[model samples]
Target: MRSKGERLRRRRSAGSRLSTGSASELQQYSELLHASPTNPYAPFDSKIDWEVARWAKLRGPGSNAMTELLKIEGVCDSLGLSFKDTDALNRMIDNLPGRPAFKREEVVIADEAFEVYHRDVIECIRALYGDPEFAKDLILLPERHYADADKTIRMYSDMHTGKWWWNTQKAVERETPGATIVPVIISSDKTQVTLFGNKTAYPIYMTIGNLPKEIRRKPSQGGHVLLGYLPTTRLEHIVNKASRRRTLANLFHSCVSRILRPLKKAGEFGVPMASGDGIYRRLHPIFATFVGDYPEQLLVTGIKTGECPKCPVPHNELGEYGDRDKLRDIEQVLNALSSITDGNPLVFVKACAAAGIKPVQHPFWEGLPYVDIFQTITPDILHQLYQGVMKHIISWVTKACGAAEVDARCRRFPPNHSIRLFTKGISTLSRVTGREHSQMCQILLGLVVDVCLPDGHSTATLIKAVRAILDFCYLAQYPAHTDETLNHLDEALQQFHQAKHIFVLLGIRSDFNIPKLHSLLHYIASIKCFGTTDNYNTEYTERLHIDFTKDAYRATNHKDEYPQMTKWLTRREKVLRHEKYIKWRVAGCPPPDVPQTDGMPDPRDLGSRPHLRMTRHPTVKAVPVSTVKLQYGAQFFEAAFARFVVQYHEPRWTAFQVEQAAANIYLPFQRLPVFHKIKFWIKDPFHRGLGSETSDAVHCSSIWA
Candidate 1:
């Protein structure tokens, strides 16, 4: 006889093949996508899920961690209507896996890790129903109803909470000494029988649109699934707690009466068990920025190799000139991912990789992280990869901070002073304790700049970072990565017109002195007003931080700056294809217009020495060519470095890339051959923070302070 696992795998494979034929049945499986979503379909885009799913499949077992990370970001972006950053992502990652037994193909989790333990239920269900029955039931599963989000337990027909949800009154009635339904609905998505005192019935409700593709009448093969089940009273109590609504306040704009669902005494959904994991996450947004593990020196980009030179793993497998081992480790982790029947597989393999114990070392423990073997592995990789786990950490952090609503706690719409409070707190904390302002700045910017996108414009915060730091200079420095940062930047830029003046008020930007940038901004407005059709709502090139809603908001109010930009317009630049910054895709080439040498030319100083400085330059025509865009996943740092070099009479182009499979992307400027040519750059280990505002201010401040 095949082992139980093989039996289950065989059953699932057949079930999948059977289920694939019917489009309706396949469509029903999408509920699984929404149930345990990596993100909500933001901007009404379903492709994001496919992108996330593709990433997960490619990354292997580690892909689940990536999946969870994506889910956290997607959840935050879709639900809160905000963004996050890498620092915030790290904090959130640390908070997960708080319970036990995690997996990928969850039907429902009936225990401590009910939130993630749905696969067990699914497995049990598959075992109960033969492969065909299992496949058919998946077709009948409900379409993901966003309105009922708090209702369903993602993967499992009814996760533990789902079981409780299905048998809510039954669980209440059974007060029965020991009774729990072995989820027939879970193990196989195609089946829907739950054991209620040996009488199996499809107790769960199903919505109209999402249903099984095929309907099966015969029970076939094993008529009843036998589960040598045990009932635990302690677990029963826990399920009751887990059954509590997920963010009632968030879900229901109107408050629910205490009589309907009693609130926990601690005023939370659940109480802390041992050490509360996310205190850092909960508090850090208020404090601002995380202590990022920014390496003091270059990452061992295959030059030094990921292997501990002496430890003797084959270093050749990892590509030279980059941390290919990290990539290999990432791939290895993805491949090994099984459901969390044991535990977090990503963390498990990560520990192995960090300790130099490759896949061959713990072959059986490939995708599952069981404590027996996992305990033996070193925790360094598990430790380092935490940063990459929660993608939009910053946005969540800002929200959590705002959730405190400390400044105007009870108001319907609080002042939303989270950023200002964080900045003020940092200033206060730094001055009183003589904390290094640079370090403090680094933490804040790591969350802000490194995490968020579109650098430093008012759109930095997912919790509306723009309105909070009105008229501030944009903080454009790269900080640590997290989930919310990129999401927040995208969302904020989507609503750029709403955040613009606030950025200016914060003095984050010098109003464009060149009419070219202004005209570009105007053209962007016109395109927004008109339509780019294909790339409509695309986030690139024309993303401006403008919020037209404010009562007192106004443009920079200087025609001199506006009209003066005519020169840049005159530069014969028709470089429109960089909208998505695609290289090979677009046709035609306009020499990539290097940013003009002039600094922020004030409208007031316009025809003065600053103005004369531009026209009166020695007749050296133009400077010699430097480098072109080498491929990079990182553009923020290189973009800044490129401009920095020209200011100090230096020239170099830098590209960013992933390092050691770590969350942090490397600028690798110092690694380039023309590294010496980047004279205008700065290292800033101490911390001014992320984005243009902090970059401009702290660079100015560090020079002064």
Candidate 2:
């Protein structure tokens, strides 16, 4: 039997253990904690109430307690804790699972200086690997193919299952035997920090493709991490506009190169990193995809604006549909960039122009191995499809069919639970979102169905064109695809192109030189290489800006806010990680396993069958039938109710008999319960998981005659 002191010592040591590791590893962690006292999850006194610290930190930024840390002391004092001071609480908050610190660096590009706040990419990658939440779902090796019993390639659902990952995996294995490829996905967007301000933040986010798309796409899942904040400062110091643009482009590359410099060595050679499963694997992180809008894509790939970033398709020929020109060659681009080394600016400019690229020397991907910058630029559905092509289509349709007619048809259209009513029509609406465009797509073809086209230019062809484009948009977003679906996608685009000449003949537009329309040609290729469009959709990143940029900025004092924003993000991440850790401990620290279904039917598999729900309590209980006819505008209510009753009683009743019975039958009740509205929750096949719920009012009133 052990003595009381020995037992107490063992208990204290157990409490101090931060991770599930060997005694030597625990000692090493203890040493590291002591060495870096500011490290979150540092050792704390046994007497300190961790429950209080968890509550306080979990409040997150913009919380009342975050604004006033002193209030937490008061709460602790009320609880009569041993450590009730603000300083102790601060220490405890700092002692949660911490994030990598941001390093502020001054980057000078062509005599212009700017500040860039960034974290180490390798450190961030390792941190993600260490996360238990991510590790369980992480795909360490690429899935070559998943075939049915008949040996047919059936499912292409994730990036790992795509051709790019499989090909890249094979290449990496050939170079470094037994090496695992970690596909790094990068996204950046410039956003306003405040509602009314010149202040802006250019945030760059990074996530690995190892995680499942469902997890990667959700901001709440914590799959995405803030890689850095690029300088938003406009170079007002440079007098020449051309020079400024060149300098700005160079600065972007410079900053990105600095942030991702570590990956050069790490990608070529493997790094032994522990995954969420607590097993160390030799992982090689490589740049696989760059998710951005058109402008950002141009910036990353050094392509001039109004040019295709993925391929060498001429600007004039973008609208022409056939086989697209071959993809941009990296060797030719590098040679053009290298022209500057000869000390001839004119030669560099001409060479870059000949190569159809911006005059950007030493792009971010210059030294990165196995990274084709042009191919890495993924298709953006939100921008290119919905906002771009759909917007243009709507404008052309409005011109072909007058706005008044469109709006009139829109207003008169019957309301369905799933479709937007467009009460005032889409013509008057300004700054429509991708979501709105999608809603419009649902009814766009219907609105122009029977409408007369000016000059008798074949309204049937117009209808076909509109239908084809809508089909392409919906099909492009499928969560899984096969060869058959890819062919269908191709046919949809072909159908639209074949019918698009009506727009030109109608004088809506002279040519189809639109870049967004041309981008449609590459969808099949991109989907084959990178899986579904949802994997790299900018919609998820736009959602991320709310939490990572906007909320983080709001938490700050609004002066030199990047530092505070990064720190706040770090603290919030720590709090969340610690919460998970605590939960794991409580659950007996079960070994990490691949996520298994609970045998319940997948929410995605729930078909178009709508689930109807009505309030148990009636809106107006025992309302007189006369009031329903007069006030509720149900002129035929009494007759309709009688018919319903007759139908319900007599299954085989004739129509003539039902009408006669409805007119003569005496009503059972003078007053009846009425419900104002009913909700229909119907599954949207395009969107997986939770179905959409829309309400339809029950009224006899008609908006249209």
Candidate 3:
């Protein structure tokens, strides 16, 4: 085998030949090649190097190579067989290249201690930029305007297509010409590490809008980076309840501010970075969006639980919808926070309460440029819509129409290919999820069809209100939206508002002062500013919790697992990045080229045309016709098969002729092939052709019934 130095020289020579696109790109690449710790690839030159790489690649989920080797040794000892030593494995892993260490910082609030673990934000950004896999799908510039053949402006679909991106691009260009705006998206959520225990992890994740949403949403793609894991403390040390809450909020803001401090200067002064297209650009990393559920939103913005995070709407008037209130001004909030300088906690709390915010000394977004903290709080379909609004609607409607009757209707509802069958009814479900709420929405209106209401209330009005809310829910989730669809969305909300008083008259709800209901009023404005709801949906971030937090925690011992989890995550990332580098080298490290945009079929243009698909092998190779009828519940199988045969043989056959031919026709084979399920794929009309394949399966097995 070649020596390590020889392998390094050969790899560098080959990489140098790849086109750099410009002088800036060449300079950056040269620096990366010579840098001590920032080099993109590691040289595998010996038997031990190959062994380590193989071990990293073959490790199982929530496990390391060392653990697996130890297990193997135990099994071999039991069988009287010899096994190799694991010291070499451990040594090789430790010596692996390009592994960044985590920093542990101790934070104190209200005389209580907490731990915050994090990595360098700028270093993480550079690592992501240097990855070759992202280069294939990176979107570097804003798509300000795009029109169709009819000259009609299309709806916003991607993050770059939104007005916020375009406005920020223009602003940055004015300040520093030829500078690129990198839209940074940050998300954080607390998740339980174990199923039965109270142990939990609060992880902060970061990604960029420079990548396509299709790529950024998938956790396996490594597009979403784990910035840090915050301490999950209840702060029981503080005796006063109010003081404890204030201290917890302050701790959160302080930890987040520390993690994101690098962006403050980088957002104003451009940093030189190499783009996916082999071109160097002066990139300004702006904090453009924050994705989280309602509780996190309140915590991040320093707002109380009952108030709107995006606007100045009063808590009591949230149910009354009409003209939108003014947006929360950051400067005004800061001034309010600074108004009381006596350092008295009571006076500070009063000043913040007057401003409708919590007593947070400094919010995470205090110094970030071109970012409206309120606007950054995006719409969450999971918590706000499905879990929040839909849950309330179900409860109100069930009470008004009687739960027994609704449960009977739900049990009697037929099975569908697209909609889930809630066999036990939704009334008894303890903790319903967003997915269950979605399935319930499909059959909600059907359950109340022509059903009478109690108290002589109008059933039509209830049906109308439910229908309008469902319409709004479905429309708000559209992958793409236009001027016309946005108007329809507004109309749906207005219709709901006009018909919502039926619940009050029926004594189901005293008032409509629901914050979730009020949130619907701002969907149009949010969509216009930040593209569609899916761009920052909390559902994607919730999915990331499994890979980034829960799984990482599982790979560690119960005591002080934060450091172990962070280190495991770093090693996993390094392994994946090195795999990508090896693949690129094997492919000859081709120069990056501009993506072809013309002549590509637009997904929106392709209407809802479904194509049937099935397995290549038959589910049942030889099942008798009689068996199919008796076991599979196909009572009219013979008649249906005869009619199909007659229609296939004779065009425009009458029913009478079909019946006559059915009597004469006989089975050519005693046994017939059976397929248990069939799938249908329809092209989605949004988000271009990237994520447009909508599929549903129909199972024909008797057990499914």
Residue by residue across 1-705, what tens digits does model 3's lDDT show? 222223322433211222356533223443443423432333444334443445543354334454575477355354332223444443444455553467999887766678999988877776566555566676666664444545365567788778788678767766766656788999999999998979989999998888888777766556788899998998887899988888888899989998999998998987777754465666788999999988899999988888888898888999987665358877778777776577787887787887789878877888788888888888889999999999899998889878888888889877688888877887888878889888899999998788888767788999999999999999999978887888899999999999999998998888888878888888888888788998899999999998888878877887889988887777666555445444344445543332211123333333534478789998888888888888898878888988899989996989899889888888787788998888888665665556447788887865434
* Ranking according to lDDT, highest score first: 2, 3, 1
Q: Number of clashing pairs, model 1?
A: 110
TM-score of each: 0.17, 0.82, 0.82
Question: Candidate 2 lDDT (Cα, whole model)?
Answer: 0.77
lDDT of 2 by residue, 81-123 (tens): 4445545655565665466878999998776678999999998
Q: Is candidate 1 or candidate 2 better by TM-score?
A: 2
- Mind giving the per-residue lDDT tens digits that candidate 1 earns over 1-705? 222223322432211121122322112322322323332332223444323332222222342344456457466466442224323422322322211122322112233321111113222232222222232232211111111335322222111211122222133223321111121110101111222332111111111111121111111111222111111112334345423321211111111111112121211211111111101000000000011111200011110223322122244421111221121343433344332235775765565455444322222223221111211111111112112111112223344334333223222221221112243333113212112322222243334433332334333443354322211112111122112332342343334334434434544343423211111121111111111111111111011111110100121122322121222111111111111111211213311222111123322222232211122333222322232233222335455554554434522323322222223333444433212111122333565321111111111111111
Lowest lDDT block of 10, candidate 3? 591-600
Local distance difference test values of all predictions, in order? 0.23, 0.77, 0.75
* Better TM-score candidate (1, 3): 3
